[model samples]
Target: MENRLLQILVCPVCKGTLRHDREHQELICPADRLAFPVRDGVPVMLPGEARTLEQAPEQ
Candidate 1:
């Protein structure tokens, strides 16, 4: 994602900053506990299209 685009993109629900997960190709909103996927270089920002995050395993 371009820096400019990423700067302007916010979580639709909380209007919070998004952290780019380059490996998974997603824009994550920790505040919302949701992950928006990037498909073919395009972010699918719709809430209905988002996936809830499962808790990561303890290390």
Candidate 2:
């Protein structure tokens, strides 16, 4: 999973590159301000399954 993620994963919405946030267990799309969840080692890439950054707690 980690191998595939780092090597080739892109945002479904914007087609932009994603950065894995291990602490959050998510793949964040900065341009789209969305976070795709990594569930049981598989990434849930659907937009509807994403969490919006606007609703996220500030770091």
Candidate 3:
């Protein structure tokens, strides 16, 4: 994701800052424990499309 885009993107649920997980291609909302996927360089910010931190693949 572009640095500018990442700077502006916020968690749809809590409106909190998101942390980009480059290795997993996800934008994570730590407060919500949700991971929004980034597919084809486009962020899928839908709550329904998010995965809970528990469901995140083990590092």
TM-scores of all candidate predictions against the true structure? 0.87, 0.84, 0.93
Clash pairs, model 3 backbone: none
- TM-score ranking from best candidate downward: 3, 1, 2
**Error in Å for residue 23 of model 2:** 0.7
lDDT of 2 by residue, 1-59 (tens): 56665668899999999988888788889999999988898999999999998787335
lDDT agreement of model 2 with the native: 0.86
Q: Which consecutive 10 residues in model 1 have the weakest lDDT in total?
A: 50-59
- For 1-59, candidate 1 gives per-residue lDDT tens digits of 89899999999999999998887788899999988988898999999988888944222
Give the TM-score (vs. native) of candidate 1: 0.87
Model 3 stretches with alpha carbons more than 4 Å out: none
Say which candidate scores most in TM-score: 3
Candidate 1: Cα lDDT at 19: 91
Error at 38, model 2, angstroms: 0.2
Computed on alpha carbons, the lDDT of every model, listed in order, comes to 0.88, 0.86, 0.94
